[model samples]
Target: MKASFAKFVILFTVLAVAGFSFYFLSSREEPSSLCPQARTTVSAPEKDARMKNILAPTEENIQAGKALFNSQAQPIPCSICHGFKGDSIGVIFQWIKPYARNFTCFQTMKDISDGQMFWVIRNGSHGTRMQAYKKLEDEQIWQLVLYLRSFSE
Candidate 1:
């Protein structure tokens, strides 16, 4: 009986450790180190030539941007690919190659300039499924940028 009890305790301890390990590893969010992301978009000079967001990140602008990101934008909403929380884990994220840009990752977002983001939003990226928001005025795009920035903040 003593030997059987010891074996049972050992088995329980191993199982408990394994269970806890799996839970913690799986539940944790992806690290910010998944950054310095590569892009095959406009030329460096062209991206640099683009202007940065002119609109400040005021509550009103951010709210407008949130609207666009959630559902108001044309073609499709940003949340469809970038996730509602900007985590890049949207419903269709699994289907997109290279995955979507994770705005929540400051390590990645910090490297992307506002002008670069503006150019991408206006012209779209070459290799990605991002579409050009020609219908959206420059100010609207800037608003969206403000909202995207809020995720990292």
Candidate 2:
């Protein structure tokens, strides 16, 4: 009877530890990062409208972008801070900075051009919730840009 009681105690301890672990992980906020133009309206000159090299949001591009969005390169998924659907206000992503843009918002995206989007993804915003993805390959950055652009009306 003593041996059986000890086994039960051990099992209960293990279960308690696991439950606490899950709660802590779920509650913790991800490390902070920011965009360069968080408060500035320093806009770049519009690039050539005839910029023939601009890639469209093709099936391949969107799919690859999705992979990157869902990737675990960092602690939390992009969806956690950017919203599972890549737009705040529409979804949750409560950790996003107050100055951050809502990806799914048409008003937010309508004014942004492809080149502007590409630069932000490549270099990240200075003082906002964005972080530079300089390590990501060029194509991958473009893919993510394309995917984010897809949310525009």
Candidate 3:
């Protein structure tokens, strides 16, 4: 009986160690498979710098923007998570775990500047559910960005 009990203890220890090792190994893979980019900043497309010329989100632009943002361009209704006006969730989560930023809040919006928002929307946030829309047309993305500006006001 004693011998049998000793064998059970050894088996249990071996199983526990194997289980933990498997968990650790699998967890090390990271959320994304792509290798890390050396640069810390987001890069721009190889197009005309005219992308910068677009400013002023007019009412007509806003209306157009709204359509662009709401459309099923990818998978989700951006406003659903960002809030109706996009003004509460914030662009970055300060303390919350994987927080979805509220887009309607203008205070945070102004801080990001147009370029940053365009990059994030186009590239999507890594380590999060945000997926880059590399396929979206430049005009469509601009329109969406214009609509997003309305949330800041």
Candidate 4:
């Protein structure tokens, strides 16, 4: 009887260890670069024919956009949802069902035009965590667009 009890205990211990090992191994970090980018069927509203990027993609403009994306000055910094790397793996994405946009994916971003992106930024995307940056000037949004374009490049 003792031998049977000892065998049962040993089997249980082995099973528990194997279960834990599998769980931990599967939980390893998944880089955002490898994750699938956000795929949206929703069409961005058309932009005004005259609307265009007022700020050139200069070093200063890019820096300003980067700062805004990382800072909480206005619109609470895009990094909160888009991630610091613009890979859309922000901390807030955990609660968001669809997740945020992964800008690194060229396939998804190729279809998005500058004007469409600008409109989305200025007027938040529907059914997503994105919020409208009505407080930010158009030029500031354009600067952010310029910064976002770099992620795919």
Candidate 5:
């Protein structure tokens, strides 16, 4: 009986520890890092018709963006690369070159215009793991841009 009781106690302890570990790790809101200086002044192509944020930074739009970032993005989800919190340290961070874009870096985001962000989201960066989210709708992309910008703010 004593041996059985000891085993039960050990199992309970292990289960408790695992449960807490999962809760703490998953509950983390965002990761903070010192971002490198970037050329934030990327200009939007004049010919691109959707060069502005049509949707306001309302809760609904931001929520929609969050949803898209988490699951709805085509090719691959944004959270897989940019992180669920837009912190750049995503699940595939090790495999990506030059690292993912850290949307939380206010210094870099400060100079990047809404139009520039829209262009990047639609066209993707040329030399990075960021592929063009061409499958996403224009409005959906705009909502995502807004959600990403919130990371810096």
Candidate 6:
């Protein structure tokens, strides 16, 4: 009878640990995998427009973009909403509706042209929380585009 009681106690303890682990993991906020996102921000002409990034994706340029994205950009940093990994699960992800674009998603990023991204970065998305980064120069915006593209690759 003592052996059976001991076995029961061990089984109960293991089950309780497993249950707590599952609960803790599930409660944490995770990034949503919204691939192939249907973007309707830019008009047909704007979406298809081809604008070349004059600045090459050199290590320096990418680092500059990273800095801007993380904390240097005016108004607010992109990482506040886009997340450090560009996964769209930012610090304020729970409060945002329609979530920020997940740059890590190749299916969605592939459809977005450089020009489209440039336009959005300069002008901001009409319906989204993304604000116009007017302070960023065209070259800086291009650098940002290059850095954003790296998330998918």
User: Which number leads on lDDT?
Assistant: 6
Q: Which stretches of candidate 6 lie over 4 Å from their true place?
A: 1-32
Full-model lDDT, candidate 4 = 0.76
Which candidate ranks first by TM-score, i.e. highest? 6
| Error in Å for residue 35 of model 1 | 5.0
**Residue-level lDDT tens digits of model 4 in 1-153:** 999999999999999999988865565346554455546636665554236677788999888889888894384888987889988768665556567777777878877778877887777778877777889888888888889988998
lDDT of each: 0.82, 0.61, 0.58, 0.76, 0.80, 0.84
- lDDT (Cα) of model 2: 0.61
Predicted candidate 5 versus true structure: per-residue lDDT over 12-78, tens digit per residue: 9999999988876765443443374344334667655346688999999999999999988888999
CA deviation > 4 Å runs, candidate 3: 1-56, 88-96
lDDT of 4 at 131: 72
The TM-score of candidate 1 is: 0.72
Query: Candidate order by TM-score, highest to lowest?
Result: 6, 1, 4, 5, 2, 3
Q: Which ten residues in a row have the lowest lDDT in candidate 2?
A: 30-39
Predictions: Cα RMSD each: 8.3, 7.7, 10.4, 6.6, 7.1, 7.8
**Which scores higher on TM-score, 3 or 5?**
5
Model 4, C-alpha of 108: deviation from truth (Å): 0.9
Worst 10 residues of 1 by lDDT: 28-37
lDDT of 2 by residue, 1-153 (tens): 999999999999999999988876685443232222233534544562212224677898788888787664243345555665665432334444554555676655766776676676666677766676667776776777777777654
Ranking by lDDT: 6, 1, 5, 4, 2, 3
